[model samples]
Target chain A: MLDFTGIEKERLRARWVSSAEAPEFVEEVNAFIDTLKELGPSPLKAAVEAKKEEQKEAPA
Target chain B: MIETIKQHVAGLLTEKKIAGFLGLIEKNGHVAPHLFKDGESLAGFTLGDRKTAGDARYPLNKTLVTLSRAYPEETFGVLVRGCDERGLYGLFRLNQLTEDRVIPVGFSCPAELSEACECRKPYPDSLVAGEKTESSQLKKVAEMDGKDLARRFDFWTAQFVKCVKCYGCRDVCPMCFCKECSLECEDLVAKGDLPVEVPVFHLTRAMHMADRCVDCGLCDEACPSDIPLRLLYKKTAQIMDTDYGFTSGLNKNERSPLSQMGPAK
Candidate 1:
């Protein structure tokens, strides 16, 4: 669904980690953080920024 | 075509198979849903044809759900198009209505109606009325799917921005039977706030109905903003079908793969 809306599928992640497996949870979170860094800021925020600039540039 | 349905329902009612048959009636040229009980006149029966093929259609299944709950002991027959049949089957699986208590009397969509809906299967497995018409060849979902990611983002953003937050999509949806909706939550969607491209309302709805959408297209029709809601939900349904091999419709026995018990045969 994220992919369908133009968001990278990698921006979302879901994994079941038992509470006993603290290391696994941390690893998953770190991996997602790395992925997010690579993807840059959210495209939704970019759309907001663009819309603001768009108003100043030319009216639709 | 409607004559066949009337005869079938009349026969069923005569045989005491159903307490009543719910269908549309044209009273004074206005189409509305009506329940035909035993010994009632069938003169006003209509298939929601007004100015166009199936232009005045209603979600009879929603009413059927309410009726079944109120009169659980009585079995009822319902007029179902391709989409209504799908909604009935979906409701059956959802446990909102039982299969044995409700009998489906189905009709196929005309070419123009089917094309307008862009339906995959515009007819039920068995028909009481109209003949099976070939599904519309339009591939809006596929066309949308083929676009580059950035283009999709912009396309969807523009569409979502136009939302007046009416929630007409959810209101008109036949497959939506949730007692409590996540969309109304204050944290999830800021109530009475400006419609944002964050698209929490639409996105949540899309994800919620991902496995359950019967492809009825009511959401698309109900949207005042004219958002391609069915197109969006169809994408989610497609992904579910691709990943889990689960598609909701006439096949009542098929279970959602997302469920903890796994797919039921």
Candidate 2:
């Protein structure tokens, strides 16, 4: 729903299912996991991890 | 022009039409906001020559709000350019001050001054000094509008990374009178994070400014990082105008659709 681009757009998904539609919810979750696998790790998370590593190596 | 303004203010003070006049004064080789009371002190009032415009532009409306809140019963006159007058109108809509309690002495800006600000309206409706000139749109916003979504996103993300989270923009904004700002909220924006969260901090501010921003460009001037904040807020104003048919600070009686509770008419 946000103005994200390329793989960033694939990183998020939303679906509405009734309480009785357990099969549909499961299918949606699986589809989201497959999409996540295809897209690999999130760029924002990678950037944060890299910053944390840099701080760890920095001299006091 | 300065003499004319001085005389006008002196007349107001002598006639007791206002308890004080809020305007600029030259002191210690600098110009700053001062409250002029007695007619005799009108000689000290100044418009601050063209050269001082860059450094001398103060949030006179914000000062007026503070003074009025303190006094409550007193009336005051203020020297206003186009931007300040727009701010007053916005404040009046927000119920910060009533129209009857404050009088505005308006003036126009020169072409060079207007060009520097990328101002769309450099003269107030009640102009008493200087001739009204054509307003200019910001060239940067126009250029950015033609770029692809990805390219525009990249440009904004790069600019947002430069932010030091100073909050100078909010402090200098005349319309930002909210006692509790979302920017300070720990949920929306985390505390003690360098560079702040990308796009969230700014986007939140942009959303808040959409209905209220008068396009004064003060936030742009106050930004230490030169982040082109005015351009972003100007785009928000454009969006509001296109989607909701609302223009801030234009009509005192008309309320922005976003501020109204019911469905838009």
Candidate 3:
């Protein structure tokens, strides 16, 4: 069921890499990259268009 | 004006009436808000040409409001401007602050500051400083209001896109009193993003500001991106003035149009 209360586990971005061939850091970095891929491109294009139009008429 | 303020404080303290006097204190070339007591230190109490470290409006207002909330039974004095007075008035309308507990020391803003702020009134309901001056109507509000919706959207979106999410604007806003701000809501504003989305981040703040914004222009200054935030809030205030024929901080009895609507008696 979808949590209606909107409480989600705290998503943290932290990494500790020890000297000499840290496989864990590389794995975590790769995982973060995969998450970014899942999220896909942001939806800022339409909003950017809207904002440009407003500036044309504002006072200098 | 300084002497006048001191005299008033002296009287209030002599009568043991007010708990504190909230006004400007110049220490080391900085004029920030300070709470003055009877016998502590009045030497630093000098007021003139306040060099704003990103809108002193919010800091001063926050001090008074916090003091009032902490000490409910005590009365306090507040130095106010057209913007500060209007913000307080808006707060009063919203039932955020009590007028009875606040003594207003009104001052007229200089021409440069007035023009920069585009203030409608440089004086408050009460006066203790310089003479009253004419109100300045910011041309930007009307200009923006006349724009087509798409153009308006574009302009504001670009402005919001540059937002650093520093919360300086919210932090410096004297009228912003929400202990839990909607901007901080992970769902609405999103978390861990530098400049969250356009309408989502800024638009939410603007909507919340609606009838509550006092056109202090502090938010604009506090914003590192220099987003024309004052123009947006100014627009909101204009809508309130036009639609309801009400302005903040002028009257003690009028309720803020946002939470509760009261007849303009």
TM-score to true structure, per model = 0.90, 0.83, 0.75
Write the residue-wise lDDT of candidate 2 on B60-143 in tens digits: 999999999999899999999888888888899889998899999988888888888777788988788889979887676667
Tens digits of per-residue lDDT for model 1, B122-160: 998758877898977548888988999999989888778
Candidate 2's DockQ:
0.16
| TM-score of candidate 1 against the unseen true structure | 0.90
TM-score of predicted structure 1, chain A: 0.75
Task: Tell me the whole-model lDDT of each prediction, alpha carbons only.
Answer: 0.84, 0.80, 0.70
lDDT of 2 by residue, A21-45 (tens): 9999999999999999987875654
Candidates sorted by DockQ, best first: 1, 2, 3
Q: How much is B40 displaced in model 3, in angstroms?
A: 3.7
Q: State residue B81's C-alpha deviation in candidate 1, in Å.
A: 0.8
Model 2 RMSD in angstroms: 4.4
> Could you tell me the fnat of model 3?
0.23
lDDT of 3 by residue, A1-56 (tens): 00101111122256777767579878988897777677565335655655455545
lDDT of 3: 0.70
In model 1 chain A, the worst 10-residue window by lDDT is: A51-60
